[model samples]
Target: MRSRHVSVWIDAPPDVVYAFAADPHELSRWAAGLAEGSLRPSADGWVADSPMGQVTVQFSPPNTFGVLDHVVRLPSGEEVDNPMRVVAAAPGAAQSEVVFTVRQRPGISDEDFDADIAAVTADLQTLRGILEGQ
Candidate 1:
């Protein structure tokens, strides 16, 4: 698997950033593509009404360590683990860093990986915008 990560700095505190990200209800607000695709809750977890059909999203429980890992279950039953975390810039700084890590599957091409990176970057930017009140 090929791993990649994208991050954005938020002016808010780590706890605040983590709280906003841990809520599934806020996914649509920052994840514009998924929202536009009609992502909604299913029996087990949230489902994204993607072009390839329904994709289920399952997230890790909220934790104090800022772990916000999640898995996306595709129509083909492939589970993609998306690792995310929020870290403070310093002990008492108001700034925080939100990082998202994605591992590309073996069969994915370079172009598709690039697109995925772009999408993740855009999503993080949107989150920053909402949190920073820009």
Candidate 2:
């Protein structure tokens, strides 16, 4: 799969950024096109009441390594893997970086890939703003 990676550095601790971004509900705030409405725990994982119907987001097991990966289940049962990571600038550092990996398949054109890159860049900017503004 072809993929693009975008990242933003925020003036906050990695733990804080990881805690907020790891939650599916919180993603709606920064990732505008991700989903909508409230998120609640469901049998499969965390479900969000979105305009596209109920979307499920299942995250990786909890860890202190800042690995905030997750999978999104569409209403049609298609799953999209969103690989994300929050890295501390250094040991005991207050600065951190959040990276998002956007993937595309064989049929994705250059224009679409560019658009996806821009969207991810915007989302990362929003994340930086939110974390830094706090």
Cα RMSD, each candidate: 1.7, 2.0
- CA shift of 22, model 2, Å: 1.6
Instruction: Please provide, for model 2 over 97-125, each residue's C-alpha lDDT reduced to its tens digit, 9 standing for 90 to 100.
Output: 89889888567788977887888798889
Cα deviation of 113 in candidate 1 (Å)? Answer: 0.2
Runs of candidate 1 with Cα error greater than 4 angstroms are 37-39
Error of 1 at 82 (Å): 0.4
> What C-alpha lDDT do the candidate models reach, one value each?
0.86, 0.84
Cα deviation at 117, candidate 1, in Å, is 0.3
**What's the distance in Å from true for residue 69, model 1?**
0.4
RMSD of 2: 2.0
Q: For model 1, state the Cα shift of residue 38 in Å.
A: 6.7
Which candidate gets the maximum lDDT versus the true structure?
1
lDDT of 1 at 19: 95
